[model samples]
Target: MVWTEILVPVLGGDNDAALLAIAKALAEPFNAAINVVYASPSPISLFSWAGEGGYGPTDVAVAAMQESADRGQARCRDLLASLDYPKTKFEAVTADDWIGLRTVSRLADVVIWERSVSRGHGFLANAFQQILLDERRPAIIADKPTKADGTIAIAWDGGREASRALRRAVPLLRGATKVVILSVPHAMAHPCDGSRAVDYLADQGIKADAVVLHTQGDAGQAILGGVRDLGADILVAGAFGHPRLQRFIFGGTTQLLLDSGSPAALFLSH
Candidate 1:
């Protein structure tokens, strides 16, 4: 399947440009249409107090929220007009409620977002993570400003999540002239033979070589090393792992890969 419709959130920040660029890159390759969304804080519910009476401040706050939404929409429109793609379409909405998620899940074939807006507080990331896990649509997240070119690496771990990510990344996989599937051997995990992985891709008309690395090092480091050695432009892997107790913990491979500066498009799934 091809990604023909992309939903990108236009959060007012410095990273908005990077988000737009990613939308363009992924969309242009497939001739897709982009839907830009803006999110604003929802209006607060008002209540009448027993002693203190008036709702004057509440009314003023609601008006301010409305004004902010209007300004944000205008900025989004100007940004879309300045972009160069003719087929690139635009939509501006104030996601003051869960309607934003519903709109994206229902209308977008793929969601493109950044890791965080300014610091670690990433509204788009939180929104799209739920979308990817629940909506059954692919979400391409730009953790940092990444250049899309060079070799491509797929981290294969023989799990349901990894399989799902691999299936979703078929279009990008087909385009990469040089693809490598790196499987690391863990103590309890059954090692995947390179031949079997290669044969599986061959059936789907994709020819890729596999390399099994038995490294006594961190999985993320090994994967990054492979990327540098192979000159890879992107890395594809599953998003999360089994939760330990009440806290959610990502596998070492996933966490390290996320923190790296290798200039790769990570295709992730849970």
Candidate 2:
């Protein structure tokens, strides 16, 4: 159950390094190919130039985009070449933000992205939230687990999503030194003792402790506190779902986690 391809969608800024850090940490050890995709729409997509000199303006805009893509690819190539890891490789692609990155994500084994953790309805944040909510989206590597051989935590709720996340995170779990299954019964729809999750991991040769939390804040905060208390370097959990309007009014646990400056890597699934 090794990852073959890891997709990393970089939107530039400080996220570039943050995204690469997680991708490298996860991919290097597994010898997986890291695909750093940059979503930069064609320059022509930005404007409406109907009264153009025939097709000259359109051609110019497209050429501009092509050149920009080339330069970006060149930088990636140089960076990868410098690393020169025979097992771990790198590839770069430029595509339309709406469809291309999503397409690539569908085929990837896992995705390591920047947990920007912003408290705004910005485009990037919205796009990332949409991805997290995508049921078809692959397993994600978040908050940057530089290495897998560390304490790992799982937020358990006796739900399908949490179960799926545990399975998806097995590869990394294999290297964990300690596993803590934190069951926050506060706001959970199907609260359990977390013993089943612990037993399941034990069956897979991963010993874990089951801890049911009784907290004052929401379930998300309880999970956060549990992770910090356990000294876990990575967190695995199912992404809880909510109505769109409700999420807009009251954010879901997964959304809040995504927006926090997490101290551990978060592996979440829908």
Candidate 3:
């Protein structure tokens, strides 16, 4: 269950060093190859141009976007080379957003994304949204550089998505200095036994602690608070158990954590 290929999107041309630092740390454990990709713009659809008079203005716009992306692509390659991950090989490529990033992710073991403060946060941008929804690959948001010896946390719900996320995170779990299982007990019916999670970790020869907390407010907030309390640097969870629309229309736990972006980093699987 070790990752072998990691895809990193270097779109905005900011925070290259930080993103590469995290990628290098993770790749060191498994000798994973890093692919730094700069996504070129997707052409407007036929229907889109029809509504906006014609392709007269559209072609000009597309050309401008391509030019900007080309500059960013050069920055990405230069940045990656400077980092010098002596352990593994890395490649930098330019491609259209739909076919390039998405296709690379489909074959990658995990896709790495970093949000730079200089760049405005575009949570639901088309390229990001498509990457998140691409069921073939899991994505990791490296909000902060991982510690030299980091602690890992897993948010558990006894559901299939949670289980999937946990399994996908085996590589991280094996290397973490400490592991914590964070759970927020339901105010309604029976809650999962937190000890079972601890026991499961024991089976893998990994020691862990379980922290169960009663809700202080929303269940999501409570769970996040628990993660902070434990000082876990890396958190793993399943992304959006509910449909994208359902979670967006009515707030859900996953959405809450995503929107706030606290606790530094998360390894999420859909």
> Model 3, 53-151: lDDT tens per residue?
653545777677667766767777778878777643444444433665676677778777764321226422555557666644676777656762588
Give candidate 1 regions above 4 Å deviation: 45-57, 93-99, 117-120, 143-149, 244-252
Task: Give lDDT tens digits, candidate 1, residues 1-270.
Answer: 677787877766666767877788777777888777776655452232323655444677778877876777777777777778767666555454446565666667767766542112655555655666666566676755344444668888787777777887777677777778887776217756456667777887888989877788877787778778887767877765555332244445565666675556666766
- Please name the candidate that would achieve the greatest TM-score relative to the true structure: 3
- Model 2 lDDT on a 0 to 1 scale: 0.71
Please give the range of 10 consecutive residues that has the lowest summed lDDT in model 3.
Answer: 115-124
Q: State how far residue 194 of model 1 sits from its true place (Å).
A: 4.1
Ranking of candidates on lDDT, top first: 2, 3, 1
Clashes of 1: 2
Which residue pairs come into collision in candidate 3?
A: none
Where does the lowest 10-residue lDDT sum fall in candidate 2?
Answer: 117-126
